[model samples]
Target: MTGGSPGRQDIGPVRQSVDGSTLSTSLEAAAARLRRRFGGRLLEEAVFRGELTYVVAPSDWLRVLAYCRSAPALSFDRLDCLMGDHLPERAERPFEVVAHLTSHTHGHRLRVKTALAEGESLPTVTGLWPSAGFDERETWEMYGIAFEGHPDLRRLLTTEDFEGYPLRKDFPLQGTVGGRIRIDLRGKI
Candidate 1:
């Protein structure tokens, strides 16, 4: 299992007995199970380019995350990281949330990504994984994505009085007041 970066390889498909029939496969199978259990809400499946990622609708994110953690084959117990992405021009959902999950026992990793439109909110997964608290908060502070169930949802990396999300693709790189290049020239000549 691999996450985030390209070149990560998933373990080859393996056979496993679910019932009377022997239906065995790779991460694709796991993704199928999730989709079947969750219905047609899943957006993208088997999208294992840079990482073994499953993109779900923002509304189904909480359920999907829980299923990934409890699913027999894809037992992702560790929450490695959670990040946010900004895609301004995308007609669909603009903000993307990526969660990296790892199973130490199985030596496998899985990435779950969900897209939320502007002003939309995603359910928090901190109930399943305590480490998600800080990660989700940071994502909210940086990308303006809100985690509905986060206990202490607040700005993490930015000041409380910060005006806008600094990481959104639409957010200007330069300051609004002066339109000046906000470059750090402290050590550069």
Candidate 2:
């Protein structure tokens, strides 16, 4: 990754050239380039609460992550975290998987989020970042999301006997109640 201003550890923004081409000014520029390349499929492109976040379609997730790693200005060599959120009640997309990417060399951070419909499986990134294994496992166990090509996909935090997904909105919070009991009144009377 290209070094930018002093104290700016990670990728920052990039500037435009006189020929109407874009140039890397900082890490933000790298993200902008990704947005330009993906176009309408790119959902969110702003830094949220101090983290660079990019939400894209599930089909384009792998390509987007690959681009982020390949782009010189934003070489996020590490997959910091990968997790999924359950939003079954939403009228639109009901599920989302969030991947956090970071570059120790550039000291930059980027978040990639992909939306998936019910029962959809997301492409595995473990091949690209081995650290994603545990994260993917946790997501799968909690959200019932399948990461295609994951080496050992299994329940991480839950027991093997557990039946339904605990994190999904549709999952019932409590098990069925058996029956009601009548209180004895002869002793009190």
Candidate 3:
């Protein structure tokens, strides 16, 4: 009932910092800092099972993430995961690339994701976090998403002759391009 807003009403007395200034939870503060820094580019916010997720637009993906890695308040220096997913249910925007970031300095975790419309590609984060090299390559091969400036994006798991993106939701269950195994006719079986 104190310090409320029109869209998001405050629940109770806002927590106070040691200096007696009103404060929000650390995660809430992080979200607010990102919101201030990104404005509309930071698209949506979701908290599921106590985990914070920030969905940014693909247009500003690289800039926002770079800010996260460098900003003093945010400093999301470690890139834990950079992967892609196909969500047919989303319909309009079916492809999504998610990055998990951790701030060892502040002991905070954030999940950042950007939705892509099937054929679109995201900018490479290898320059920001060199550890993302392998994950970006794998995501590129599996989801058919290219990291625009990746240094050495080659096949990580599948072969060069692989026809389709195996990790896509629409990919065949058994196999697509690879030769099928004849279990019954094979003498080894």
Candidate 4:
């Protein structure tokens, strides 16, 4: 979080060095563009290790990504990856969905993130980037981060009767005790 809180829209554009090595500048420009376009919907922005990350409201997830994809200044037309992080100790929102995007036209990368409370549904971005369909399904099955509006939302790597989310930080290492078992031992004994 190099810059001050960028949640405010109305902030002035950041200036880069005249020499034109503008990784930070480009990141700021993306943040500014997002801020200007999304207004208060932009929750927080940060530049870390020359990479820009924006934390946005869950309600604005699809719209923000759509803007990044379609807007000329951004044109982040590629969805590199979609993943989830679970921090169950946080009382407010324990789940985070991180989307990595790249702009072949603009020649930069940015990470968009949104936080969701337990059981909160995430708006699907598969419509914007069809490649995210299976990734979202994997995240859903692994972390239980539900993706709303996903056309075929189902467990990608687990059985239909899987009990709990496996990737949450709080999930037990040995697995849940006394979970359901469908085995029958009629004549074997």
Candidate 5:
């Protein structure tokens, strides 16, 4: 994990609003606000399919999410999705934790992403959004992304004895072990 401040420089350029509505806030504006508040902790920003996406530093993920949830102007109250992706090709950061945040009042959706190398830990966002607990646990079990500070960080999909993250790109396609034994009581010889 790279250790640095949040707002060392400004984010992407703000384009003119297409809708021309004063109430509507552009993604650039939000990124700028977050950059100012967090100060260089936010790593990158981009727009995809009209959704604002920000790649945040791992160390600052919790702080950024907490602010986004509690701040009245930027109340990203709804955590629509929390998932993990594995990028084996990427040498520095092989795993990514993506979160989709929705602001019902503001009618805006933001995607926050934090990248992690193997064995690095990601802070849990369940404190800001309780729904994250399940997703985090699943990520932990599937991609082996350990979420620090999770109240109940445990396997949600896989068994306790399960080994290795199944979702990694390098994971084998074939099964390593069979499921539990099944007995045929009706046709017992």
Candidate 6:
């Protein structure tokens, strides 16, 4: 295993993090399995509300995902969801691609994230999870973030003639955006 990987063989004894809180055996096992594959490419790991999330490097995105799906030890075969986030605050890498993966064999789930710049695109994961077909298209349409290898990446929700990303933060709040239909319910529900 490479340096910065999380595992018993490489790092040894993952019973607790620096905070000294015990982690579930499954999480440790999953981390170890991932370490065996990707090593130190994992940037950060966080657990909130008992859910584990890993921040991955954009360059390693495709390989990490492939490992998650194919590795027997990790077997994260389920692509629960895939979405994109636009964080204008982070200028260097403002766009984020988040994948929710679940392993039925391990009975655990993991959230993986990778950040990219405005023009950068991620390799499509549709090859790993067929369910990601529409999700990637929808995300690309809404966020204006491209999926480089997506087979059919055309707008799924918006018309082919539509212009601009509607879900982007900077998208016009009021106006005829991409010929959108609007009903002005003047201050009343």
List the candidate 1 regions with Cα displacement exceeding 4 Å.
1-29, 47-51, 176-189
Give the Cα error of residue 81 in candidate 5, in Å.
1.2
Model 2 scores worst on lDDT over the 10 consecutive residues at 1-10
| Model 3 TM | 0.79
Q: Rate the local accuracy (lDDT) of all candidates.
A: 0.70, 0.71, 0.76, 0.77, 0.76, 0.77
Against the hidden true structure, what lDDT does model 2 obtain? 0.71
TM-score of 6: 0.82
lDDT per residue as tens, model 1, 1-189: 112222223323322222323332455566556656754555544443323566676667888899888887778899999999888767667788899998775566678887778889888899889899999888988888888968999766654467788777777887652232344459321
State residue 36's C-alpha deviation in candidate 3, in Å.
1.1
For every model shown, what is its TM-score relative to the native structure? 0.73, 0.74, 0.79, 0.80, 0.81, 0.82
The residue-by-residue lDDT of candidate 3 on 1-189, one tens digit each, is 012122332222223333433333776778778766666565565565445676777887899889989999988989999999989888867888999998888787888888888789899999999999999999999999999988988877775577889899999988448643334355311
The candidate maximizing TM-score is 6
lDDT, model 3: 0.76
**Prediction 1 TM-score vs. true:** 0.73
Judge candidate 5 against the unseen true structure and give its global Cα lDDT, from 0 to 1: 0.76
Tens digit of lDDT per residue, candidate 4, span 51-106?
67777878888889999988988989999999998876666788889999998876
Return whichever of 2 and 3 wins on TM-score: 3
Find the number of clashing residue pairs for candidate 1: 0
lDDT of 5 by residue, 85-112 (tens): 9997778888999999998867788888
**Candidate 1 residue pairs in clash (backbone atoms < 3 Å):** none
- Candidates sorted by TM-score, descending order? 6, 5, 4, 3, 2, 1
Residue 127 displacement (Å), model 5: 1.0
